[model samples]
Target: MTREAMAAFMFRMDGTSSYQAPKVSPFADVKPGDKFYREISWMHSQGLSTGTRQTSGKPLFQPKAALSREAMAAFMFRLEKPKAYQAPKVSVFSDMKPSDKFYREVSWMYASKLTTGYKAPNGSRSFGPKQSLTREAMAAFMYRLETTLRLK
Candidate 1:
C-alpha cells in the first residue's frame, strides 16, 4: 500500500484530514476494485495530491518508507487550511536556504508551532526542511499541533 492510500484510509475512517501510522500491513497488490486503490482515489478527490514519485507511471507509495518532512508538512498544510489555522512561526529552520522548495512549508509549520526542528538542544530549533521526517518526529509534531493548533 502507498502512503497516500494509507492516509486516505485514515481520512475516511476518521473523517479527518490527518493520518495516523497504521499498525497493520497496509499494502495489497495493485488491481481494480481494491480498497487500497480506492483510498488513493479518495485522497485525490479530496485534493490531497499524489506526488510524482512513481515508476512506470504508477504512484509508488512505499508504505514502509518513512514520510519526509516535505510530505508531512504538505499534508498538514492542506489539512489545516480548512480549520483556519495559522502557523505559529513563519520559518523555523535557520539553516533552510530560501531557495529550497519547502521553505514556505517549514515556515508555516514553525509559525504554528506544529513541527519539530532539526537536532538542536533548544528543541530541534533548526529544521532542515529537506531532511527526512521520521515517524517519531512526526508523532512529536502532531503532539505539538494538538496543543498549539488545538486539534487532536
Candidate 2:
C-alpha cells in the first residue's frame, strides 16, 4: 500500500472518519490538489508523520515512496501511543544497536510481535529497518495490530 493509503487507514482506525484540510497545511508537499491531501494533512496535524525531509525548505511527504520498516514502526508506535513503553538495554537486531534512532520503536515492534527480523545463515537477525516494506508485510502488520488492539 502507498504511504497515503496507510495514513488514511491508520486515521480511519483511529476513528477519524472524515475531515477537512486545515487552513494552513503542515506539509509543503501535500497540497489541496493531492488525492490523499486530507489524510496526509490529518496525519501531520495529529503528529503521526513528521515527513522525512521537513528540515529542508521543500519538505516532502513522498506519499509514493516505499514505506521503510523503521518508518512503519514509528508510525505504529505513534498510533498506538502505548503507555510507559520501555526499550530493552540491548537490541534484538545484530545490525541495529540501542543507540540507533529507531531502536526503541523497532524494539517495541519485536516485543509486541509485530515483526520478526530476517534471520541470516549465520544465525544473526537483521531488522532491515531501512528496507522498503512490502504490501504483504504491511497487511500482516495491520492485521496483527488490529488483533492485538482488538480494535473494532
The candidate maximizing TM-score is 2
Q: Which stretches of candidate 2 lie over 4 Å from their true place?
A: 53-58
TM-score against native, each model:
0.60, 0.86
**Positional deviation of 82 in candidate 1, in angstroms?**
6.8
Those runs of model 1 whose alpha carbons end farther than 4 Å from true positions after fitting are 1-38, 53-65, 82-91, 119-124
lDDT of 1: 0.57
Q: How many residue pairs clash (N, CA or C atoms closer than 3 angstroms) in each of the candidate models, in the order given?
A: 11, 0
Model 1 per-residue lDDT tens digits across residues 2-117: 36544653465435445433433223333445445555544544566455554556554454555567777777676565355443344456676556665666667876767656
Instruction: Give the C-alpha miss distance for residue 12 in model 2, angstroms.
Output: 3.3
lDDT (10s digit) by residue, model 2, range 1-152: 57887877777767465677876667776778687788888888788888867555746788887788888899998888878989999788998999988799999988888888999999988999888888788888888888865553
Shift of residue 8 alpha carbon in model 2, Å: 2.6
Per-candidate local distance difference test: 0.57, 0.82
